[model samples]
Target: MVTLFDLIVSGFVALVVLPLAVSSLVAGSPPPPPNMFLAKYYLAEPRLMLASNLFLLAVCATAIQRLATHFGVLSEPVSRSLDIWISVPFVVLLLAFLGLFIKAILTVRRANRAA
Candidate 1:
């Protein structure tokens, strides 16, 4: 009962997301080319690229977990365990990002008010 959407998502994860995650984990971030305008930022903050790649991997993993559950590939208890483990970190990260975003906005507003 695989739908077109399922096939597309699985294909994207297998072909693109998985490879990018594996490469970033194994090789770390690659050095940006000298001619590239963003090379300075890349070199200055390599961890940002790694963190983003890991976040992408986490999202793909969560998608795959949901797909597996939908297909009955995972049992109830095991699926619940995986869900808890995978989802907790993802939720925490999401909240952390949201907090940072709000903090940034408030900081900017305060600065504007002061000026």
Candidate 2:
């Protein structure tokens, strides 16, 4: 049941993320293709992939903490540490995503100008 629920959640997230990603890529390109292969290249781009994974990791950590809390497994200290761990990755991923977005924007601008 849990596995099925997780699969559903993941599919929902993918449905959201992939279209947003494809649209971003398409908008950036002047002569965009009808369909971009975002999934094929998502993991191939190291900086973007790392940023995405870091964000996902932070989310998963929070979810796990919540589950643990529901099961009465989280003490005060454990909860505090989990929050710290979650925040660190969240901040790091935020910065990484910002940097990568800026870099991509610059690259796209350069391409537009060159064209």
Candidate 3:
């Protein structure tokens, strides 16, 4: 029973999650760009980017774990609908991570299969 409040919470959480996730992913694995693009844009510090990327991964992992607790998927007593206030954001972020993971895996599979 997702209400307007739930929708709002989910949207905000997704917005935050996607940017951090995508930026970190890009910074970590910089694909070689074309002649013009390569020289123009490059990671300023690969080490820092890697560190920040690891930090983001840790934070997201903890968040998703908390979300699992909210879902009781990790084992806990299910509370009442009042938990929706918390569940909305947790579930949204968890789903976002799941979606990203799935997409990344699929992309890898496709590339592997192609090669």
Each candidate structure's TM-score, on Cα atoms with residue i matched to residue i, is 0.60, 0.57, 0.36
Clash pairs, candidate 1, are none
Name the runs in model 2 displaced over 4 angstroms.
Answer: 1-34, 37-46
Where in model 1 is the C-alpha error above 4 Å? 1-3, 32-41, 93-115
Residue range 1-115, candidate 3, lDDT tens digits: 4456754555554457647766858765553344744222223222333433444554554455445555566554443343555556556655655555555556656766899
User: What is the descending TM-score order?
Assistant: 1, 2, 3
Q: Report clashes for each candidate as comma-separated counts.
A: 0, 0, 0
- Displacement of the residue 86 alpha carbon in candidate 2, Å: 2.1
Cα lDDT tens digits for candidate 1, 10-101: 76885688887788777876665878875544454445455556677777788788677777888778988998899877887666545544
Question: 2 or 3, which is superior by TM-score?
Answer: 2
Error of 2 at 20 (Å): 17
User: Best to worst by lDDT, what's the order?
Assistant: 1, 2, 3
After aligning candidate 2 to the native by TM-score, how far in Å is the CA of 111 from where it should be?
Answer: 0.7
